[model samples]
Target: MSTVPETGTLALPPLDGLGQLLPRLSRRWPDRTALVTDERTLSFADLDRESSRVARALQDRSIHPGDRVALFSQNRWEWIVSYHAVLKAGAVVNPLNVMLTGEEVAYILADAGTKVLLASGERLDAVGDELRAVPSLEQVVSFDDCGHQVEQFSDLLAVDDDPGFTPFPVDPGSLACIAYTSGTTGRPKGAMQSQRSLVLNCAYAATMHGRTSDDVVITALPAPHVYGNVVINATFMVGGKVVLRKRFDAEDTLQCIVEHRATLLEGVPAMYAMLLASPALEDADLSSLTRSTVGGQTIAETVIDAWESRSGVPLIELWGMTELSGLGTTHAIHAPNVRGSIGVALPGVQVKVADTQDVTVECAPGEPGELLVRGPIVTMGYFNNTEATAETITPDGWLRTGDIATHDGQGHFFVVDRLKDMIITGGYNVYPAEIERVLIGHESVALVAVGREPDPVKGEVAHAYVVLAPGQQPDADALIAHCRQHMAAYKVPRAVHFVDTLPTTSSGKLIRRHLRSSATANA
Candidate 1:
């Protein structure tokens, strides 16, 4: 096992405001590369100066501290600059995913009570009119000129940097960012993260990953999401260079790795699956890569093994959520024996297992239960939704993570499944991840999702949707028989549907709701 850092017990500093850290880092690593988009690279010094200019421009427009600013764009250098610029002015940032519909975008803007919006010219048509309709939004700033309704981002950069602007007095508990969940449920609720929570999470990640100035981190995920934001900001916090990708493409990612000689790679499981299947990967030189990690969804061991076989680097599985600021548990790169586990609790974090009744359970090795987390890294609460906030955070400060997991005696945690994803069949509880993991081990299976199929007698039964590997043929009976060899009969999938591909979210999480709906529609 890799030696954990010797940070004796949780005597952390009263979280200093991010407003202070950004300026300090800017002064320390001014010449280092801070962000790299497809078309341009911004050094730390350039990012610092440009973001200061943006702060001044916003202030000149009467935007003040405690106001909410929205950023709706893909991962780009401008996005990074705008994020910090919003924070520099002590304003709250609301980053909306570009993949959202106009209505979804409108809901978030209104919910956050956003006063200003910063977006790219390419995405103007998608939400420009919708944002105009929001009464709470006082101003709209665009990366390019958009007639009268938008302020040009370049014009903002041309303004004189405000070196004399007084820093806002921000409390550690004040809202810093409102990141909306993917809305797998009904409407997405904004997860409120404070500057104290976000900065502490970044520091924890830096310690776990052993990040340094020499590491070049490639962020291929969208910045609007929590996973992408944490990785990008954490890289900067450690004085590492970040190579950004607007959209994830297997060939482009391989080329970026080779061209930039990237040392660290952060992506979700779908990105890895695509890269493993890409023809470009066969010829690409991936020798520069050393550290690679994945989160956002549960990853099958088969994918991990395939990636390690190809790249000579283990795919460290991480477990986190938007409320936790994107890191609660991560597999230690230095500890290869715990490759399938989500390593130990990150430095300054505590994790435990609780039964269905919310009682703390002393789980023996290999037993699974709901995972509960408490630490400086956890978010304070949801924005404005007091009911939801109270339900999520305990009175004692522990955040009930709705993930089902098991831990080995050695302290390594493996995600069994999601609490909501558990299917009840004949009164027997079944976790889809267990079935999915077993199915992926089959040679004929390329990708798979295990979900519940409605049954009149049982309410719901286990079902599998699988994509077959090219030229490999396997019938439903054979697949079921194969599963029987590794699992109990009740836990085996009752029905199987072969598909071309499983539906996944933009971030590469399998859209299980789609699967359920598809099964119902087909029936």
Candidate 2:
């Protein structure tokens, strides 16, 4: 399941903060376009100025050092600027998932005690009411025109160039961001990450990915997430131009790569599959793309073959998590995907496969067990959830990654089944426990179990099984529609099944495997 070690790990030298690498890039690469969008572009120098302006805006709102600033917006140049500004101001940036419902967002804002929020238009409306109710939230700014009780992003920039902001001293372990990750647990726990941790990952990516100032990157992931943060920030650190997209559309992403002469394309397996499915891919001039970093779950062999055959670029697969600042094991440069291998641990990261009975014992090669990751890139811990954090990270500094993987003695790794019941559908992480909890709220359901069903397109989707109450009879469409009102769209179960009784252990714990087997039989 593992492959030979990669050509480079984190051979790249370190910097203080992730954004600290920017000023130097701007100074050296002055007029080069630092970021590109469909409608606007920002040069290296412009990015510095914009970041300064954003920092000043936060200061004007009385944001203090170490305060949390929630960035509840989609991808845009401003999003990048806000990231730099928040860091410069010595405040932690909480990148809110754009997919979460308003209530879910409000919960995070309240938990993080966010003072200032930068949101996109639709995002503003989605969370406006909840945001207004959060007393800790002092100000709100929108990147686009929205008739909300908030300041316009453009108006904030009209100040007489005197942003009056200064960079604050930062420690390697100082809290830099609180990225909320919904794992197998029903609730989203904020993973506390530091500036040093993120910058280390970015620097490592910049070195290992072979990026240069002339390189142009096309991103196919959500920017608020850690993966997108690493790709976008790493590209910036390498003084490359970023072609930012609000959403990942196969045709649009491919067209942008060709038009911009992008040198790198980064995405998850679902994204690669979608790109391969694109009609434009057959004729699109993709010579500009040198390689593609396949993030998230390892891709299927046929999909990888199709992508290599179609794009003529190597789909370099890597394994990582939000806790690890977005990178872990990646293949050696130009190394082929050998039998679904995720490759060895990246530079600066120490990985081991431990036995289930005794974590102290390392698993032999090709033997599936719990995967443990250790590195500076790992999160400090979960915010305000010390118990969960304590459970995840051993006192000795190793993080129980909660993933089932195997590693060969030569420093290679391969994924087995997931140790956690988190389903990845269309590149989105969907925790079955979260969906199951929500479904249990339905009055018609006496009991419920949620599991993943194999999907040809999305990879896998949530499939919920329900046993109705004695007299109540609920329809599938209605139950699904109800879930839409409670959770994000991507989290809604793709299909619903009604059963007389669900299989369970003698101790009364619902057996998900039995349900999965039944689903397979029915399919």
TM-scores of the candidates in the order shown: 0.91, 0.79
Q: TM-score of the candidate numbered 2?
A: 0.79
Candidate 2 residue spans exceeding 4 A from truth: 1-14, 162-166, 334-339, 422-523
* lDDT of candidate 2 at residue 21, scale 0 to 100: 61
Best by TM-score: 1
Q: Tens-digit lDDT track for model 2 on 155-226?
A: 766655654444666887889999988533577899999888888887777766777676789985777787
> What TM-score does candidate 1 get on C-alpha atoms?
0.91
> Candidate 1 — what's its lDDT?
0.81
- Evaluate residue 56 in candidate 2 and report its C-alpha lDDT on the 0 to 100 scale: 73
lDDT of 1 at 65: 83
